[model samples]
Each structure stands twice: as structure tokens, then as C-alpha cells.
Target: MNPIAANKAELIAIADAVAREKSIDRMIVIEAMEEAIQRAARARYGAENDIRAKIDPRGGDLRLWRVLEVVEEPEDYFKQISLVDAKERESDVKLGDFIVDPLPPIEFGRIAAQAAKQVIVTKVRDAERERQYDEYKDRQGEIITGLVKRVEFGHIVVDLGRAEGVIRRDQQIPREVLRVGDRVRSLITLVRRENRGPQIFCSRAHPDFMKKLFAQEVPEIYDGVIEIKACARDPGSRAKIGVLSHDSSIDPVGACVGMRGSRVQAVVQELAGEKIDIIPWSPETATFVVNALQPAQVSKVVIDEEDTRIEVVVPDDQLSLAIGRRGQNVRLAGQLTGHQIDIMTEAAESEKRQKEFVERSELFEKELELDETLAQLLVAEGFTSLEEVAYVEADELASIEGLDEDVAAELQSRAVEALERRESGYRDARRALGVEDALSEIPGLTEEMLVRLGSKGIKTLDDLADLSTDELIGKGDKRREIPAGLLASFGISQDDGNAIIMAARQHWFADEVTDEATEA
Candidate 1:
């Protein structure tokens, strides 16, 4: 009971009980006890005294001693002894050798016993936490069931049997309520071991949660016949999952849906009746995108592989279905397919095509001295701009069926003249607008873009740098909303837009330092 009175067997018994209760190794507990007793011995002797305790592994007998190194001259009196003094204690003792002086046992006082207990308890708890962390760290992304322990600041703390998991407010299923003692299933999103303990972060709204649920409901998925490729969820509203079958005979969708939707129904119920679309994954993005937008008949799919964009032309009746309510369906389809999708009705697409045709025809007519009939031919040949006719090889232009080499050459020369004149006029206008030529040097911005920015009172690099990428791209709203992105008409990419903005922002650092120096 009392420390120092407790013998070897009693110390070993205490270690065994502590290790069993904490789920740590008995040897770890024994080491902790030895360290605690060593600290107590140091306290009883002197603070500067180098004392140590070693517990016998077989019998757990405690041995206390003062450890001092043999040195030529005693620098510190507590931990070092002169070689002469050490040689007197042991005839064969050499310099730098540690001399262990056995100390007589002393009773551990109230304070000393409490210090030892704290040390043992702290060590055992650390060992337990370490074990828990190791046990659940590898279980990340796996679905685990737990009871809701409590809710604090919208965070749900779930009580796993051994280690607790936390589901932050954003990770919970939307509109799904939880109460203490309510059992819930969640996918482990992340796991971290900190000084406090292992923090197992879980999520019910994660797309992986739905994937795991389907894995549980469908046998083929677990057996590796069906593989869930990608998943997108709107929490309690809707979800889309792309599945592929390694075994051709097994229809991945049919296997996941089960008989009369039995398997999918089970998963849907678990997700609070969220609607799910099981899409057959395809390597061809167009086919996969068409599959992703299910229940909506696609009349035609035009895929822009370079942009990873899919244009789905649905019938007039299917447009609403293809786009979904508030664009959620199409958005989720894009996410699942990993492509940007543009949904248009057949009628709307035809109208857009006609509009583009007229625009291209007019461009050729004015720029290449082509009449309606001649411009119509160029438009039919898919020559969208005069610049293309001017820049492309003569053979490419001549290859357009009826246009001979002489005619093609003449048209190209006219196009070059027209574009040069147009560019000269744009340069004059830019100067008139007081827009910097430096801004026009940016990769994505054109003369027209400079004029637009200048008209908006952005004339300098400083002014341009003050604006966001969205504003430069025309996506950001000013007094009026520009629904389309910046330089959208000029076909600027988001990456190019970001690069242009960054170019504009290069002067920002210089300007900042100048202003700071001025203020100082």
C-alpha cells in the first residue's frame, strides 16, 4: 500500500493491473513506475543528484543508486567524482567510467507518492492514446458506426468504443438532426494525433460516405466486380456516383441498383432519402457525361476534349431535365464526369449555330471583300475568322472544294490588309482612350479588352492590379453584372486570365514599398 513498503511482487502486480486497465504493455507500465520512483529518490536525496531506479523484469525488485562518472577533477560535486576518489572506491575504476553508489531505502512521503502516481498515470494514458491513434489512423476513409456523445458549437462528438471521433458542423448531413445516444454512421475523413490525443475527424456528408454505403449494400462492389469511380453529393438532396465494371457481364448500374432498387433504396434511406443516380463509367468523356446526366435524353453530345467540355444538346422537352432544378443535376453530372458541361435544347442550339454562322459570314464579307455567296462558302468551310484565312496555309484555303489557289491567295491578301487596318484603328482608339500599351502586352487581353478596362477608368497597371481576376475576366459584377468571364468573347482561358492578372499585379509590390517609404 505505502511506497517503499511495497516489495517486488506488489510493484509487478500494480504494473500488471495498470497495463491491463490502460491496454498498454506491462513492461511500459513497469518502466513508468521505475521513472517515477527514480524522481522520488532524486527528490529525497538532492535535486542536483543523478539518481536512477531499475526494476527487475522477473521479480520487479526496485534498486536505487547515485550515478557518477569518473573524471580527472570533480567539476560538479553531485554527478561527477575525481579519478582518485573513484579509484579508491574501486581499484580498477578508470576515468569516464560511471560509478554506481547503492543508496539505502527510504519511505516515500505523501508528496513523493503523489508525484510517482501522476507520472505512472500520465505515462499509461499516453501509451493508451498512442495505441488508439495507431488503431484508427489506418481506418481512415472507412465507415465506422458510433453513438452521438454530445454536441458542442454544432460539432458532433461521436463515441467510438475506444476512441472518440468528431464530425464538424459542415461534415454532417444537411437537415439531419442528432441527439445523445443516437447511433450514426460516418466515413473517417481524416485522422491526426496531437499532444492532447488522436483526433479522428468524420463526415456523414462526404461523397466517400455514400460510396462506402453502396459498397456495403452491393456485393459485387465489395467483391471487386464493380468499382465506384467518382461520387458527388448534395448531402440530403441528391447524389451521383459513377461505377465501372471490371467484369463485363456484370452491369455495374444494375448490380448497384439491385432488384426493384432494393440495394439503392437501403443506401437512400441511410442518406435521409437523397436521390441517387448510378452511372456507368466510360473512358470516353462524351459517353461518361451522357451517362452521368441520366433520365434526360441527350439528342447529341459534342465534346471539346481540349477544354474537357461537353455540350449536351437535349430535345426541347429534355432541356429542363438535363439541366436539373437550379442547375444541380448538370452541376453534379459535371463533377462526376470531371468535365465542364453546357446543356442546350435542340432548338436553342440551332439558333446559336445560325447566329454564329451570320456573325462569321459578315466578318468574311467585310474583311475579305466577299459577297454573301462567297462569305457563305467560307462559313460553310468552317473558316470562322479572316485572321485564320490570312494566317493559314494557302493549300488549306484552296482545299475548300470550289475555291481555287488564285482565289484563295487573293482572299488571304485581302484578309491580311483588312486585319492590319483594323488593328491600326484599334491602336489609335487605345491611345485616344489613354489606355497603356503595357496592358495590351498581357497574354490574354486584346485591344478591345484594354478599351473596356480603360472605359471603366482602369488606365494604369496600378489600377488594373487593384481589380480582381474576375473583374478583369468580366465575370465579376460592377454596377451591372457580367455573367460571362473576362475576355470570354475573345476566348481567354481561366489560367490565362489568372496569368494576365498576375502580370498586372507585378507592380503592386513595388508600389507598396514606395507608399510605405513615403509614409515613413
Candidate 2:
């Protein structure tokens, strides 16, 4: 068959069309076509030697060059031309130069055409994958909204604008129901490269959902006027957000709450109805901590500087509220406030006789040469009982700011002297109530045990001391992770727990009644 004339115009137009359709450079298509044509021509029958093909755009001609050597050895048989053969083609020719011979019509069989087509498809696919990877690799930690494509094996696949994302089972709220084609918003947790496509990891159960909600609903937060300083959450159950305002005129808490609680309510709805608490951020540890534990008023805040702990006390009615159903409130509050918060009820305080000492704290502060703030700090650091502080070394107190060695020494001496004198006072107070031997008569506790307990500030037999085996032994499943077996070793039982708690309450009432009678 005769060779088809080179259609240069058709070749250039096809290259441009392919480049535009495939989103590739026109020069790449031109190079691919040249490779296809050269491979086809070189593989034609009886032309197995090395043959190079070139297209002349000016004249629209396809030229073929056959390379051959002049050496007798012909190391490369296909490319060698003997001296005699070279002279036959050209009377005056060099021995070492390659010969150029014209090639016959070049065409490809079915197998060669299939191989060329496959090469083009593979090259275009690789280019597309690289382009997609470049577009999405930097969008980490941002929120993206997309349509739910389908669910596969408990994982939700979402169709993002330029790519797809997978919401793994663990990143979804437990028992939450979703449907196909529904729109969902999630945080982009990770972006990964795969052979087939870009793998994006998304989450709806992240604690940052609270912060993202505020950013969407609150104008102040959206505009950078208010910043979400920190957040702690239990995902679908509850969340606490700490917000600070750059502009004093705008209140971060009020902004998060919105008008009549619209903003927070909207966020709660989006989170499968999770409860949210918005607390104002504070630079001061004491004030920030108090605000962090909201809906539960703190009667006193003790800062334990040495241990980085803060003990918060609430009234009897607010104990359950402060701790939430299973200590969730205090746990999240502690995480948000960056402190270890210990919550206790008023009943516990009365049993420990902490109230009596709590009242006389001011007087002790004065006698001990400590400010009220410093005294509170000392109490917060596990030195709740006055006797503990009385025995503290002067150097130890001096280690704390504002308490010099001389002042700590003087305070220790005075507190010890007062403890000696107050021993008789306590005995007299107990005797006047007619139950002077009540504590010593308890089933398993000895005098030494009672004293050790008192030193830890467990002076009374109220609910705090009267804890039942289950109440004391129940391991916290969610937050505290307490062990049940540990509380059994103590001489604490259900019947005695109730009786001791009642006796402690009665003693407290008796003391209050006598004080009133004496005043009258």
C-alpha cells in the first residue's frame, strides 16, 4: 500500500485537542505522537535495524534515517556498514561515519497500535493523580462541608468539592444515624496519598466541634474579635469551651451564648444534642478556675502551689451538680481549667470538722503571720488540718513566697503552743455534749487511727467518713478510673457508714445549738 501523505495541519490540531481535553500541555501530546510514529516505523518488516524518523514541519515531509557502521567487525550488526558496502552506496565515504539509507513504507500491526494506546492512557492517569495531590495536601486542620456519598462497612464516604473523604467508624458519634445524599460538615483530620487517589480522613466526633460551632455562629469569633482559648469535651455527651475576647467591649461568653442562647443551641443541635458550657477565659488561675466550674458555686478555692492542685468546695445541694452524674462536669472542668479539681459536699466538711477550723481561719491567719490568701493556699496543698501546718518547718514555709524564714518559725511555734492549749478545750467541748466516748466506742477504729484520721482533717464521723463499701469502692467507669477493691481494706461498712454519718451530723447540730444558747 502507498504511504499516506503527512497531514501537518491535522497533526497539530489533534495535539491541541488532546491537550485541551486531557488538561495536559500541548507539547506533551506532540512528543507522545512522535514517539508512537517512530516506534511503529522501526518495528516494520525487514527494517529491524536502528532507523530514526523525523517530521519536517516546513515541507510536511516524514524522513527516515538508517544508521550503519563501516568497521569490518560490525560490533552492532544492525548498525554496521562494511567499507565495500559503504562505497557501493557512496563512492567517496569515511570508514567510521554512520550511513543513512531511506526506509520503505512504515505501518504498525494490531499489537503495536494497542501498546501505543495503552501508553497514552497510563501517562494521562499519572498526570491527573499528581494534579489532584497538589491541590489538597495543604488543607489540614480545616473544616469542610460535603455531601454524604455512601456508607461502606460502617464508614461514611463524603464527596468533597475536589476530592472524597472517609469518616471512619470511630470518628462518628455512637449510634448516630445518617442517610445517603445528606449534607454533613466535618473536620479534616488527615490527608494521605494513595496509588489510586488522595485519601482524606475526616471526623465529626472531635472535641473541636464545639470551637468550630462557635466560629460559625458567633460573629465575634468569626471576625477574630473573640478567640476560643481552649476546649475540653466528651464528644456527643458534653463540652466546655474557654473563650477570650480581643476587644473588651465584646464579651466572649455572651457572644458564644448569642441572643437568648441561639448560638449555643444551634451548635448543640449540630452535635447530636450535646450539652455545652461557655466559660469566660481568665489569666488569673483562681478566677479562671472558678469560672471554669460553672453552675456550681465554690465556697472556697485553695491553691496547692507545690502540687499544682486546686480543691473546690460546694454546698450539699450542689455536690451532685458540681460532679455531674458520674463526675463528668468536674472532669471536663479540670481539663478546661488546667487544674486537678477535687469536689466535696458540705456534709463531708462538717464530718471533718473543717467548718469549725474554716471559721477560725482568719484568726489563725493573723496569729500565724500569713495573709488570708497564703493561708488558703496552704490549706489547698493537703495541709487542711491546722496541726499539719503547725508542725511545718520554718524553711518549708519560707519556700513559699511572702513567708520568710523568721515569720514561718514564729507561726510554727505559736500554732504548736495553741494546739497544746486547745487539747483541753476540745475535751471540754466533747464532754459538755454527753457523747464524750462516742468516737472511741466505734467498732474497729483505735485512738491512734482516729488521731491519724484527724490529722488528715477527718475529725468528725459525717458522710465523708461514713462512706459505704459500694459508695466508697465503686470504680469510676468514665473519668476518675478509681478501683473498687481498694476501699474494702478500710474498716468501712454500710450500716456503720450510715450510723457514723448521723452521729457526726448530730454533733455538729449540738455544737451550733450550744453556741447559740451561750450567746443568749
Candidate 3:
């Protein structure tokens, strides 16, 4: 059969048009068409033949060849040829080189032409998808607008001019109705390539979408005079953004808010009226946190940095506002600032203070056997722990509200007796638990720390070596976070936890190296 060739000018014109339309290289389209033509040619020849098609770029001349690689011996008939046979065709053919045998032109059959068309379409579509993915992957976090093409399953397929993106159901604002042909704006959250094609996933409810909206509306933000430090969203309801300004003249929050809420209102309209709080971010976490709970007026903020938590005290009238409806406000604030926020009213703080005072008063009453009035007096005078009482001078105790000099002497005696009794119990327990003296050699590991360690079954150096840093200086039973109180209790820094654990693990590591060397 004669090889079926299309018109040279027509083939070149089709490739150039397809390349322009698909936003892919013209050469890629030509290569794909060549592959399709090759497949059709292989169908007319035998499937067992190794076929390839080439189109001349200068003249658009199509040629077909059966490709055979030169080898020691001809491996099957289709793909490999003996070196001696290859040498007959070319005087100095190499063993690994391919020899091209020109085949007769293929005639266009109905089935063969359809097969060629299918291959071309498939490759062109694949190249189009790859181009779209590469183009949009860098556009991740950018805001783009598109017409709603259709909804499949729960995803909204958006026809973004040359390409399509999917806005998944969860990513859409909750209960915000959408319809086909509706114009929608979204942030490109993810672009992933899979076997079928590249998928561009979009999100309308993402916090970044709000950020991009602000950037578009506010000149200071877009021009880098102001920055959005952190953003959190309770999509379709409320959101918080922490902003900072490099220029002293620019108030970041005011810049985002615009004069008379013009700038922010534009963004709010796009977000389907999502309530947004624009806060000025601060380098001091307490100041940032205080600002994050906006409109509610935070009266005080206590931060525990190791636990990455902030306790926010607001006025009783502002309590509901600070927490928002269903605690959404504080929760989003926590997410934005990377801190666990606990919101409380001023009355609640006062109640907690009273409850703590009562507890400490009970501790003094139970531990020191002092009178009820005297225990209350000691607690009111700012003495909490028994150690404070035991360590203070007799004259210092006398200066308390109720105690006379003789009463102070008696109190000091009882305080020392109480501590000695507590320690004597710890000493007996330490000996019974078989805690080694070597553990005391660790710096900052007090006798009390050793006793606590012994109680937790970490009495020996090997036992300590097996413990993680979280177990040593962390009070976190869940989430494995280090709490400030635990760090302060040991008077150790965050890095010191790892250092102490490693100090115990030194022998273990040394033994491992020794065994490895011996094996070598």
C-alpha cells in the first residue's frame, strides 16, 4: 500500500493552529501528529514491525521507516538486527546504533485515519493539560476568576478561559449557593498531576483568598508597604487577619480598612459578607494576641510561650464578643497566631484567684498545723509553699499580720519540721527505689527532680537515656508540647531538655559505634 500523506502546507497549518490554541509549543504538536501518523502506518504494515514517522520541518514531507537496532545477533525480527546484516546496509555500522529501513507509503483507510485522529487528539490534550498545570502551579495562592462550567459530584468545574479548575465542595463557602454560568473568584490552593491529567484545585473559602482580596483592594499591601502577617478564617461567618506595616506613616489595619470602610467593604462583598477583623500584628505575642481578639476589647493577656498558649482576659460585657458565637472568634484567632487561646471574663479571673487562695490556705492549714486564722494570715501575706516558710527568718515571720515574735518562732519550728518530714519520706523512698547517685551528677537535676524521676521509673542513667525530651521537661500528656511551668520547674531551657537526654544517651551511642566498628 502507498503511504497516505496529507497536503504539506495543510499539515503545517493545522499543527501551528493547534499549538497556538492549546498554548503549547508548535514542535510538540508536530511531534504528536508524527506519532499518530506512525501508529496508523504501523497498522497498515504489521503490528510486529518497528515503525516511526518523521515530518520534514522545512517542507512538511512525511516519511515512514522501520527502526532496527544493531546487536550481536538479530533478537526478534521486528526491533533488532544482526551486526553483519547492519554492516551490509552501512559499511561501518556500530553494534548499538539503529538502522532505518524505508517502508512503502501507507494508504489512508477509514479505520486507520480514525486511529490517527484519536492519537493526535489524545497527545494534544495531554500536552494542553501539562501546559496548564505548569502555568497554574506557580499561580497557587493567586486569586483568579472564572465562569462556573458545571458541578460534578460536589466539585464546581470552572472554565478559566484556556483551562479548567475545580472548586471542591468543602472549599466553597458553606451554604453559599452556586449555579452554572455564575462568575466565581477563588484562590488556587493546589495543582497536582496524576495519570489521567493535571488537576487544578481552587478554594473560595481559604484564608489566603481573603488575604488576596485585601491585597487587591489595599495599595499598601500590594506594594509591600504593609504585610499580612497571619490570617484565619471561619468561612462564611467571621475571620481575622494580623497585618504589619513597614512604613511608620501607614496604619496597616487602617490601610486595609480604608476610609469609611471602602476597601474592606469591597473584599467583604466578594466573600459573601464574611465578617472580617483586620488587626495590627505586634512583635510581642501578648500585644498581637490582645489585638487578635478585636472589637471585644482584651483587658489582659498572659502568654505561656513554651506551650504556645495565651490566656486572654476580657471585660464581662465583652466575653461573648471575644469568643464569638460558638467560640468561632477565639478559635480562629488561635489558628492565625499559632497559639492556643483561652478567653475568660474579668469576673472569672477574680473567681479563679479566690479559688486558688482558698486552696493554698488549705495547704498551709493541713501541712503546718497552724490555726485557721494563722493559716489564712500566712496565705494572705504571700507565703504559699511550705519551703518559703521554712527558709524565711524568724523575724520575717513575725512581721506577718497575726503572728507575734514568740508565735513566729513556733511557726518557723513547725515549718522546718514539716519540710524535714517531707524530705525524710522522699529520702526513704529514693533509697527503696534504688536511684543511683550518678543521676545527681547531671547539672540542675536537684534532689527533688531525682525523686520525681525515680517515682516515674527513670531512676538509672539507662532509663533516662530511653526517655524522650517531652517526657523530661514537658507536662504535655497529649500533643507532646512543652509547657512553660514544667520548663521553669526544672529551671532548664528548651535546648537543655535535649542536652540532658543526650547526655544520658551518650553511652548508648558510644556502644553502638563500638559494635559497628567491630562488625566492620
Best by lDDT: 1
Candidate 2 root-mean-square deviation in Å: 18.6
lDDT of 1 by residue, 201-244 (tens): 99999998998999899999988889999999999999999999
Clashes of each: 3, 3, 4
- Per-residue CA lDDT of model 2 for 291-351, tens digit only, reads 8888888787778764457877789888888888788999998999877888877677656
Task: Please report the candidate that would top TM-score against the real structure.
Answer: 1
Query: Which candidate, 1 or 3, would have the higher TM-score against the true structure?
Result: 1
lDDT by residue (51-91, candidate 3, tens digit) is 98988776788878999989997768688999988889899
Could you tell me which residue pairs clash in candidate 3? 2-105, 3-105, 3-106, 4-106
Worst 10 residues of 3 by lDDT: 477-486
Q: Please say which candidate is ahead in lDDT: 2 or 3.
A: 3
TM-score of 3: 0.76
Task: Estimate the overall C-alpha local distance difference test score of candidate 2.
Answer: 0.71
